[model samples]
Target chain A: MNYNFHWRPVMKALPELLEAALLTLQVAALSMVLGVLIGLGLSLIRMHMKGPVRWLATTWVELARNTPALFQLFFFGFGLGAVGVHLTPYLIVLIALTFNNAGYLAENFRGGFKAVPDTQIRASRSLGMTAFQAYTRIVIPQVLRIVYYPMTNQMVWAVLISSLGMLVGFRELSGETQFFASKTFRIFEYFAITAVIYYVIVKIILGAASLLSKRLFRY
Target chain B: METTSRFFSGFTPNDLWFLAEAAGRTLWISILSIGFGTVLGVFFGWALSVTKTAGTLTIAPILDIFRSVPLIIQLVLFFNFAPMIGLRLSPFDAGVIILTIYTAALVSNVARAGIEAVGMPMRRSARSLGMSYWQDMRYVVWPIGLRAVFPSWIGVALGVMKDSALVSVLGYVELLKASQILITRTQDTLLILAIAGAFYFALSYPISLYASKLEERWSQ
Candidate 1:
């Protein structure tokens, strides 16, 4: 029990660790953008498409949601490498995270779609708009609004899950913390600092989301 | 494809059973973690539901911190730091302890919300019927609140199972860790990884389906 707490090593590494935290945020943001698009596509395919195409959509959502993201990351990275399709660790995490986020959010978006009344779409259709126009102009807006908070939740999840990048050697915040912690032998201090950073990053995302929602959702 | 073909040479069928054992470890750890969480979660949830004292205010912020951070970071921190604090913990012990803390945080939220969702009028009506506090809760609040909470509890259970994968990083030989070991040994990443994913899917899908059925039945 003679362990002495030291913060000096962690203090000196703040700038470097903060940069790594920013990288974590960047990867998470990029994944969120990709995930939303893929999720929307999956939801539409599951809803409107038929036959094998729809089956593919259904399978991706089920498999992704049911499996651990770590498993998916390894499966995508090494699995592809097993087939002579190598990917960088960065690409591996981005793709795995995007796919995972898409799978979860596709289901969320599907529920959002159900929550919207069918009459809204029919009304837009009868107003001389094409089916595509009706969906984009009328239905999609409502779906987006309905899923906005859940989208924020997914964004937070994507940020947190990106820490798995550490395992795959992507050098995000957690990876960088491990690197510094081992080098300085200040394991507790290094991890303690990064945990605070993660907490702050999540708070910022939630804060920004609420601020943005205040504007977009104001009636 | 050639790499995949070459990988077949090092692979053995028994690795499937090895993974099955690992999957069993994953489930075992999940049950222990969630079990611990349920006990503390109910206490904290009940505390948060009743805003009677300074204790509730203090506990709320502490729970909020646990909820905010990633579980992986928490797991790694606890595993690495326990030695410094002179507490000896095996990787499995450390993993289960930290995950239980995280799970309890989430479960408490579920409990608090579920209780609130039962509404005050229902509680007041039960009180007017001359039921004691314990009797009122046992008869009225528990039934309604638990029904509302059941669906979300299943979601948390699924989440805890996946989060358990993170314990593998600390050298706990769970399903994900077993997959990593197999990959390094056999080099058949695609097959190994897919089988691991299938194991997880098998574990979670039925729980989700059953929860959905319960939700539907309640509607009926």
Candidate 2:
């Protein structure tokens, strides 16, 4: 394939890409927090609740895990607007990502919970620990340790999946790349630079998470 | 309450049919895209595993490029650029191509892990049994490696299913696009969105459940 290479437009658009990357970082960080909270809540419900709540938790986990993150975003971002509710574009994007992240996070956390020895719970109960106290003191920390490694993967996914936020007009990195690509018609250059940015960001985050895991879990 | 009523009232029979039709398209697109992705993925996976120099050092940087490039950007490039280069493609074709490449990158990594997980002894023994390198790979290595990696492969498939929705932005009448159309027409936000989510759940939940079951059975 014959191609014309140009750097001038890409150079000019670097600022936009940087702005987009910043938004991407913001979205990913916020969504990771939200997803972790939602995941913890779902996992706890699955562990301690009965009947419908457990079923719902499992169902949510399956549905989110099975479906594409893009689909969830589209369903929430555009579909929500279809039925008459107009949430802020970013919030809609965040909600969709939160759900998607929660599904996988819940599964990871559930596995961690499973890894918590039954005897520990028994011991805690015998010591007059309430169910809440038992979970917080005896179960959650251990589960976090078990789940930490996978949390790194999920966190990376959070960063990657944040690109879909662009689809709903969130103006994240990918969206900014597209904006530059369309503006200058330098598609490859725009995409190539942003792609590198993404890889670097992911690598840095994963490295940081791994270091943090070592410190926090010491394993 | 008024807002909720309006949202609930948005679904007409035509809208239901529209969604069903869209679901059919979504399924067709997903199947086709995943099929291409699976083959290309396995091939790239094999390439990454066997070709020591390319596999170890070079392929990863290239694969990193592919993985980090957003699917939407890739699709846009194919959608907008293909026609300019005398490679006219329908939106569906473009979508499939984009997904295939993206999913292939995923498959490559997962498949490489699977192959590596099979360990060195298996390869050595197969070679000692007078098997050619290609023969050993085809007969002994792939079957076991792929089976071991099936859970992860399914995870990639799940990811592909989700990413396929991005094709809707290119105006393919996939499930999400259909919902977008309904939303624009009816102006009901919550009910239609919830219904769309239910439809997505319908599409995805079974595959996930089956994958979970398969993971359990395989690991056992």
Candidate 3:
């Protein structure tokens, strides 16, 4: 344990890690937005569509939800290129994450849709709201109430999972930590701090999400 | 036969054997970690639940602390710290320890939900039957609560299976590590990585589907 401890190396690398953390946040945040939109569409279609359409959406959801996001990242980042639909490394990672989050988010949103109660939908319809109008103005707003907590939870999961982006050379926080650990061989100090940083970020996310839920869901 | 044979093309039977052997390492690590994780998690969960009002709020905060930390840091910590602590282990062992801790944290959450799901009425009924508290918990509360949490346990199981791939970062010869090996050795990036991905999908999807089925059936 006679290893030399230098704060200089890690401090010098801190800015780089911060930049990488921004990339990590970007990946998680953008993927979350896209995933929600994709998931909402898929869940709405699954709920309303009849016959083969419902079957298709259900199967798609099952496949996505069941498989690990890592496998999905590999399949897209590596496998799709084999078939000639090549995307850049970052784009592949982004798409992989979006699809991964969408599968789970679709389920959360679907649960939310169910939680909105049939009586409310009927009430809105009886009030002369068109089907489309009622859904946009009433159903979506109410569904958001039930969906907010779970979606936020999923967002936290997404942030953790996005740590895998380092695997594909995305140079996120984990990736930078790996580089710093190797350079300094101060693995304990580096990893301990990285873990703390991640912990702090997730706690902040949870706090913000709870606050957002309070403001958005008054009822 | 076609798929298997095509998957093995231009490679000797020995090469295919090596791939399967490497895949075995992946499954072995995941299963071992999950087993360790489940036991640690059950205790951790029970401790968290039973001690919530005992004025030791430290445990829950620690659990929260563990949940927030990244897995990579844990692995790195073990890799560097073990030798200094006189508990030297290989990268594979280190990965298992880290994964076990990570899985334990998640499992405790799952277990807490199971405990809460059993309801106070069930607890009250057990008390009214003249059973000691531990006796009642062993006989009455645990069964229903554990059954209710079967789906959550399965979810965690699936999660651990996927997380086994993270062990690759430690240079373990898991599926992801094997993929990296193939890519480095052969440079047939697509074919080898795809094979690795399929192996993972094959391993993880059944557990998840079964869990979904259980959730659907039990919730009804």
Candidate 4:
């Protein structure tokens, strides 16, 4: 227990860490947006479609869920590269996170959809609403409400999974920490602070989600 | 085509053995951590249920930190922090230690919910039947509570198994790390990744399917 603590280097690089934290949030938020859109489509297809199209969506969801997020990130990073489709590291993280998020969120959305009674859709349809209008105006809004908490959980997951970007050389928060830690050989100190930063980011997201939920679900 | 030809040696029997060993390590570590974590989690959960305010003030926040931070960061920090404090832990040991705590943190909540699912009235009834507190918990609560949270416990266990891949960051040669090494050596990235992913999917999918089926049955 005689090792000396070093906080100076970590403090000096706090600004860079903060910037990288923002990048982490950006990638997470962006992936969550894409994930929700794709997940909704996938859930619908799974619910109503047949043949290979539904199979494709099912495969996507299973593969994403059944594998490790790091493995998925590698698939996007190196697996695709094997077929000669090279992408930037940022795009790699973005695409991989989106794929993983969509998979999990699709399942949650499916559960949410199931919880909404079929009678409601029929009720809306008989109210002179078109099928699309019934879905958009009646079904989706309720489904979103039902799945709101899960979506918030997914967003938190998105942020956490984005940390895998470090392995693939994406210069997000964890990657930035790795970079500085390697240079300074202050592995413990650098990662210690990075962990704190991640904790604060997660807390903020949770707080904001709670506040947003109160507003959105106000009766 | 030239690069592909240069690196694409056919997959050998040795590589299969390598992957099998790696998969075994992955399963071994997961089983070890999950076993210890669940036991510890049940204890923590019982403590939390028994002493609500004290547990929330002390154990809850500590567990929250484990849940909040990414596993990779926790691994990295603990891996480095170990040597500084004069503990000479191997990568596997450190990975298992952190993962156990992480699993315990998650399982604690599930365990708590399970305990709570067995209502206070039921516990009181058990006590009135001349059961001691421990006997009441063992006979009345444990069976019922375990049933209530079995699916969630499975989810946490499966999650911890998948998350064990992150331990590869600490230089433990689990399944993911094994594939990476093979990819570097053979440069057959697609083949290696496909096999590795299949191994994971095979290990994970059946159990999850079974859990969901069990959940459906129980709900009915």
Candidate 5:
């Protein structure tokens, strides 16, 4: 109740914070792209492949899903370093987020794949479509539609989890906020602004996602 | 061997004891938060369902703020802000308060969906049978709604349990923080992390498996 509130320092740092926000978006978007690609591959392998490969994919999905994201980031940061595989903080966060995103996205893709009936694939094949064509044109699009909402959610999750970059010393939005807050000791003002930035970012993502869904899924 | 001795100390049995105690704290905090959160969430959810427009205007947006922001940021903000407002809260207290609210925000949605899943006709029938409103809720709505949302509730609970790890950021010595301390002491990064991951998986995997199985059985 006695502490004086300061907005001036926060205002001075706003541009840098916004710049860091872009970095946050960039890393999140990159991770989501890589995650979706790898997730799709892992789901397909789990569906079609056998033996060690499928087991490896299952292990990846389960580990990602079951453990906390921060733990995974720490593993990438220090655990790998222990084995002499050094990574920059940016790479650590990127790899960790990608690892988490791919795991969760793989499960969503699996469910999506299952939701597409076997008969549809068989019918496409019977109509003289090649296996590749049956999958590419007939199945994948439907699976994408089924998974579109979850993918959007995962994208938001990637953005939220990227905030953990602060702990590893990566200068994402939260990290930059932490940096300035420590210097100015305007901890509340700095984080309060960061939270608003996050809220706005989330709203924009949801808004764009809904609009995109309209375009992509319009029947 | 020489390099190993220089860089890595033996992970003593005491470290295992330390982790187990920290694991207990993790469970205790999660349980406390989830318990309080669920009660508050169920009330909020009931209110949201019962008073749609008013609830949407008031409660829903506030709850949405909790949902939209990252938990870590929320933790940092609340931890820093509390002392400024003359509330002398410990990290543990602040962590619990914030986590409880976060959990409630999530659970409120699940609870509302569960309530909605119990159709109007079902409740009407109970009322027609001369049951009082509270009686009808207790007898008809509660059981059916619980079953409908049980898996989702489990998902939220497990999610919160994992998310409670974020509380470590506030300097609460939970399982993850304990392992960090151990890693620093032993420099056995891989070993300690593996053990911590295993502890998490052990706690999480069985419950998730059971939830999925229940969901499948319920769907059938």
Candidate 6:
């Protein structure tokens, strides 16, 4: 009870901390873009392939989901180093986040694909559209609509998880906070502000998602 | 090529047993956290459904921040803050407590949504059948709500299982921590983490498959 709260040290370090927070968002945003592309590929692999071909994608997604994201991050980070392939922390995080994000979103997108009946694809194909055009013109747009909300949730997840970049020494917001907190011996204060920043970021994501969803899904 | 051979030959019975033991610790932590989380979550969900009281209002924002904040930060904060507040707990205990809180927050939302998904008509019908509020909930609201909640709960359970790995950062030598040690000594980081991930996959994949199977059955 005797420990006093110190705000001055944290306030003075605000600019650097803010910059780190932006870095967190930047990595998250970049990973999300990569993740979506990977996830789409995963869903397609799961949907179209048979036997072991489908199982390959299933195993990848299940491993990503079932194991800790930390392990995935370390697996690629340290695992690759063990094989003499070195990647920077940012690259490691980007790759790991994309891998993990694609796995989870693959499941969500798979579900979204199911909700859109198979007959539509068949109908598009029968109407002289090739398989590629059938998917492009008919199936994918509906799949996007179906998965939009879940994609928003994934965005929030992507941002929240970017904090793990700190563990790998990526110098994101939480990493910056830890550095200052350790330096000033203000573990509580530094993390407290960082927590607030994280909270605001999540709220903004949810708020912006709802706005976008409202417009995008107007019926 | 020699080191590659060494990596493959790096198998010892003792190392295998160590991995098994680490898997046990991971399962133990996950089981305890999920049990506590489900219990508290059900309570909060019930409370939320019953009324919009002050505590009900307070529960949500608290869950929001807890849910949004990364598990590592929470662990660091709680592990450090414990002694200062006169609560003495080992890292294992701290990890369990925080993981339980994190799981409970997510479960609470799932439970609340499940409860709400049960139509008002079912509750009203039960009430009109001479059932008290508790009787109505027990016989009608809960049964229907739980069905909807089951699949989502499975997802949360898998999440908590994997997330327990985060406790490694606090020096609790679960699967990931154990792998880190083995990696240092054996210098086989890829194989060790790959083995560790297989253990996790062994633990989680069956349940995920089961959930999906059940979802298909239930929807049918």
CAPRI grade, predicted model 3: medium
lDDT of 6 by residue, A67-107 (tens): 88888889878899889999999999899989989998998
Q: Which ten residues in a row have the lowest lDDT in candidate 6 chain B?
A: B1-10
Which number leads on DockQ?
A: 5
What are the runs in model 5 whose C-alpha is more than 4 Å off?
Answer: B1-8
Instruction: Tell me the spans in candidate 3 whose CA falls farther than 4 Å from its real position.
Output: A50-56, A83-86, B1-17, B53-56, B184-188
Q: What is the C-alpha lDDT of each candidate?
A: 0.90, 0.81, 0.79, 0.94, 0.95, 0.88
Model 2, span A93-189: residue lDDT tens: 7888789889999989988988888999889999999988998998999888888888888878888888877677777898778777777788877
lDDT of each residue in B30-105, candidate 4, tens digit only: 9999999999998898888889899999999999999999999999999988887789999999989999999999
lDDT of predicted model 2? 0.81
lDDT tens digits by residue: candidate 3, B1-220: 3444233234345655667787799789888889999999888888877887651476667766667766656676678878876787889889888888888988988888788788888888889989899998899878998889988798888878877777777777877777766666665767777677667678877877788788888778
Deviation of model 1 at A193, angstroms: 0.3
- For model 1, the superposed segments whose C-alpha errors exceed 4 Å read B1-9, B52-56
Model 6, residue A193: distance off in Å is 1.2
DockQ (Cα-based) per candidate?
0.76, 0.45, 0.57, 0.85, 0.86, 0.75
Write the number of the candidate with greater DockQ, choosing between 2 and 4.
Answer: 4
Report the lDDT tens digits of candidate 4 across residue range A122-209. 9988899999999999889999999999999899889998999999999999999999999999899999999999999999999999
User: In model 1, how large is the Cα lDDT of residue A148?
Assistant: 96
For candidate 5, list the clashing residue pairs, or say none: none
What are the per-residue Cα lDDT tens digits for candidate 1 across B108-218? 989988888788998999999999999988999999999999898989989999889999988999998998898888877888888888899999999988987898798
Give the higher-lDDT candidate: 1 or 3.
1
lDDT digits (tens) for residues B1-220 of candidate 6? 3444443336577997899999999999999999999999888876776676775678888887788888888988898888888898988999999999998899988998988988988888889889998998788878888898899999999999998988998899999899888888788777788899899989998999999999898888
Model 2 off-target regions past 4 Å? A1-6, A79-85, A123-138, A178-189, A217-219, B1-15, B83-86, B126-139, B188-195
Residue A180 error, candidate 2, Å: 4.9
The TM-score measured for candidate 3 stands at 0.89
